[model samples]
Target: MATGDNLTTTAYIQHHLQNLTFGLHPENGWSFATSAEQATEMGFWAIHVDTMAWSIGLGILFLWVFRMAAKTATTGVPSGLQNFVEMMVEFVDNSVRETFHGKSKLIAPLSLTIFCWIFLMNLMDLVPVDFLPMLAQKIGALFGADPSHVYFKVVPTTDVNATLGMSLSVFALIIFYSIREKGFSGFVAELTLHPFNASNPFVQALLIPVNFLLEAVTLLAKPVSLALRLFGNLYAGELIFILIAMVGLWQLPLHFAWATFHILIITLQAFIFMMLTIVYLSMASEKH
Candidate 1:
């Protein structure tokens, strides 16, 4: 018999969101299970698999749309998809121009791809939190699997690994730009000198250590900040949806209202991430 106190809504939702771990005990596991299940039970990898699948699918779809639009483009009159893609391209081009002064033949396209890819990934938050997972469960059950263990989180941006991976990629780009613009010696000089120039050799020796430490910390902090910002916002939004859903099926009106409000969060996070990437790249392009 289940007691109402034991069946608290918060606990229920938290349990659903909990990662499935492997081992005899829940606390001690030989390995982390992809979905909630015992080692004896067959695991459904496809539940979590769809999140990446959907993100890549949408990215490719957009790429195809833009490619086709460009292929059929005309000088006389641009209509429909061509105009829409052109507007997006121009918008990204302007951002690149504003942020990066050097030749950006590669950077412009990269920025455009980042903007569209991240926006589409963030847009996954707009989908009903349980919809895809539920559909996935149904599909799994058809293929002779238990529905209860089909755990999947659709919003890739909400995943810390995903967001950190993105930030680290940006970090790599920053390093690459720094090295490309300024040679190894120039890069080391940026870290040690410029901002604080010491007239005497003794003063320069004292500042070298301090300057290097500051630059090192700043470089590390950039990706950490970027990762946490996106992860925190998206994770919080996802948690809110889970909580709302746990408040009984009758809370449909409130759920709809919250979901409507979350649209702003989804869009804002995408824009912030994109803007931050541009800012970081701009900083890289600078002498300092």
Candidate 2:
């Protein structure tokens, strides 16, 4: 945690968790943050350079692997990469088929992409928590930046913003499909009606407001839960790794033990995110 220095426990944790932030400063104009305090003060307009870089790079890696497999396909027995790709595709396709009630060409591919992309991001957690950040620090020193100013969080899912961005995109899809399957009026009715129905016209009108309030909260909760679930799990895992790293020689066994267990967590979180997306979209497509 000290990175071979005398950093206090809280400072060590804060340093590892911080993202390399870039944005405008009221005093310095546009510049990368030199401290966590400065980054927080930069407000909503600031960008996490490392989170964006790692996420986009991993995304491209996902596309390249799949593209290569598709291009190198054969009717004969498949190579290792082709076989792995086929199994992943088949797994996602089957998951979608079993869960999604409505027809959509987009769902299977979307599920596959979500599963693979998020899994890749979570997989970064298995890397030694301090490894990349230390490397990032050394690199920064070469560029005349202070080691303390160099922050790099390898796992994007640990950042709430990254997770929320993904969940909100899924939420947008849910809204899009709901309006597409049900007309605008049907969509509005779906939100405003049901869960509280009445034969009396006056009572039904009164129930509309209550129903809308409940349904709106339920609708908004989908993305909020989705984002928090992934972020919380990975962030906790990362924090533990940082704690374990502070132990001198014992870190080796402890780290591997945790990493072995973490494999399942990473895979399950990815599957859960993808599965929930399918379920939400399927619900959106329903006529009720």
Candidate 3:
């Protein structure tokens, strides 16, 4: 348990917010932080160990469940798990078909993974605020670690690094698709010619820099928007939950109400992320 000296509300909130960070400590080499000050000293090389663990764990869970459903799938009728999995698969397939203009074997599965994995991550926010952290503290004590300093954050989507990591992966796929659909020279020309074109040689040559600048910004903005929008909404929602929990016994009603409303936000954000990814890739695959 935390000492009474560390029992202030600000300390409580900050403790919940801090990640279980691990990295090369400035003085101690590679290690986990025993305190927030130690975490900050680890600098840019630090990784949010809890965030990576939860996110990757949830992702593996998704794949295992879907794989099991597929393995047991029946032709005539379906089990409840199979039925639900089929419905989700059909929904993702339809969404990808509606949005993506070009053909690729990867889009349907990628969209499904993004939607389901993100939805799972967002669902972690619905867990009771202090339950896992408390459990983690108990476990830490068993391992001879300081329970007060051991921290674990459950929701991965609320972390900016996690969101940006997923978005940047999508950005890489966009570049790959663009290059595959259009040759290297064609890709460069698309970045330096369209939206403003000229037949005259001199005028066309002069427009290269202008077109490249505009197109570059537009391309970069897709991933930036994807990352920030998700991180912003989920972070704000998590913060609100933390604030409500500060009310003690009065928090129950408010917590239930916010969690109910937040279901829509979570589902809509996942859909938007999947759809925008499809749209961006579609745009990249286009000739014009």
Give a tens-digit lDDT track for model 3, residues 128-246.
Answer: 77888888889989999988888888999988899999999999999998999898998998899977899998999998899999999988999999999999999889888888988
Q: Give me the overall lDDT of model 1.
A: 0.74
TM-score of 3: 0.94
In order of appearance, the predictions have TM-scores of 0.83, 0.97, 0.94
Report backbone clashes per prediction: 0, 0, 0
Candidate with better lDDT, 1 vs 3: 3
Please give the CA lDDT of all the candidate structures.
0.74, 0.94, 0.90
Top candidate on lDDT is 2
**lDDT of model 3 at residue 5?**
55
Query: Which lDDT tens digits does candidate 1 get at residues 100-185?
Result: 78875677887778778877887877777667777766886797766555556677777676778889999999888888888878
- The candidate maximizing TM-score is 2
lDDT for 234 (candidate 3): 91
What residue pairs clash in candidate 3, if any at all? none
Model 2 — which ten-residue stretch has the worst lDDT? 1-10
Cα misplacement distance, residue 23 of candidate 3 (Å): 0.6
lDDT of 2: 0.94
lDDT of 2 by residue, 117-160 (tens): 99999999999888889899999999999888888999999999
